[model samples]
Target: MNKFIVVTGGTKGIGLAILQKFAQQGFDVATCSRSQKDLDTLKSELEKQHSCNVIVVKADMSKRNDIKVFSDAVIKLNRPVDVLVNNAGYFAQGQICTEPEGTLENTMEANVYSAYYMTRELVSLMKKNKKGHIFNMCSVASIKAYPSGASYGISKFALLGFSKVLREELKKYGIRVTAVMPGATRTASWEKSDLPEDRFMKSEDIADLVYASHALSDKSVVEEIVIRPQLGDI
Candidate 1:
């Protein structure tokens, strides 16, 4: 059976790049996004362009019920996901005191809660096989604190700690967990920021790193990798 890779937020930006890379490499690629229209378009594009097995499920990652439904759909395909990439997230930027309560709550739900639910539900399939690679899409916000980035940073910081514990717990089962933290990435989220395009990293660049790191020998696992743009911090 062909290996399968599952990516969330696969309709656009970094998630889209990772999905394309996996498809090009002949992996059975499965992904989820909230927009059924976007998922349909992505399915047609990948099938036409790459001639590979690509599955897109409409899922709102922020909701636990949606993730459960998405996982059930993926499993019904009858192929175990060999890798899971938790890339579904949102961004909220504002001064701390001025930021609304909704902003903080939404950020936490999208960034942290979504990932926790996905991993918790999806691990059963991986645990049955006792072989899998799980990558959490963390950010520089995880490693370093920044001004006016409290809400986003808090969730990412929690993810970093969660990744560490997940590593230790899953290690015995032959599952490798990695936290990939990129300084700044030029995605829809970054576009909304007042920063220049050149001030950040490309989504494709991060996708390439993901592919390469996973290609390493099974005996050699990278627990965490932090990458920053050469120019400087945005």
Candidate 2:
């Protein structure tokens, strides 16, 4: 049986690249996004391009119910989840003191709560199987505070801490957990930017790192990965 991998926000950017990488490697890929049309389009394209199974669900990862529904859909596949990538997140820009009241809370909900709820819903299966890999998409702001980063940075810091704790907790269960922190990766988030593409790392670079981490022996786990462009943060 082909291994199964679930990725959140799989319609575009790094998430889409990861899905493509794993699908090319023959892993049955399942993913979710907020847009039904995007899901449908991605499903059609991936199924046509890759021989492996492609499962797409229209789900808003920030909602607990949506996360539950998404997890249930994957569990119904009856295939043990070999990997879960928590890659759904949004970027918010503002100074900590100047941002609107709900900005911080909403950012936390989108970036932190989404990953937490999704992992909580799916981790039991990994524990039951005594095997699995989980990747949490963090950011360079996770470690270094940047001006105007505000809520997004706070959310990523929380996510990185969560990933670290999960790694320690799941070590006994033979599950691997990794926090992926990338600096200035080119994605949809930067579509309006005037900077050249070379100023940022490609999403495929992150995907390749993810595949490499998973390719390692079960006994050797990469707890965290920090990828940056050779030109440095932009």
For this target, which candidate reaches the highest lDDT against the unseen true structure?
Answer: 2
Query: Each model's C-alpha lDDT?
Result: 0.87, 0.93
Candidate 1 stretches greater than 4 Å from native: none
The C-alpha stretches of model 2 lying farther than 4 A from their native spots are none
Q: What clash pairs does model 2 have?
A: none
At residue 182, what lDDT does model 2 achieve?
97
Write candidate 2's Cα lDDT for 113-226 as tens digits.
999988988899999999999999999999999877899999999999999999999999999999999999889998888998789998999999999999999989998899
Model 1 clashing residue pairs (backbone): none
| Residue 159 local lDDT, model 2 | 99
For model 1, residues 97-200, the per-residue Cα lDDT tens digits are 88886887888888888889889988988889888899999988998888778899988999898899999999988899999999888887765578766788
TM-score of each: 0.96, 0.98
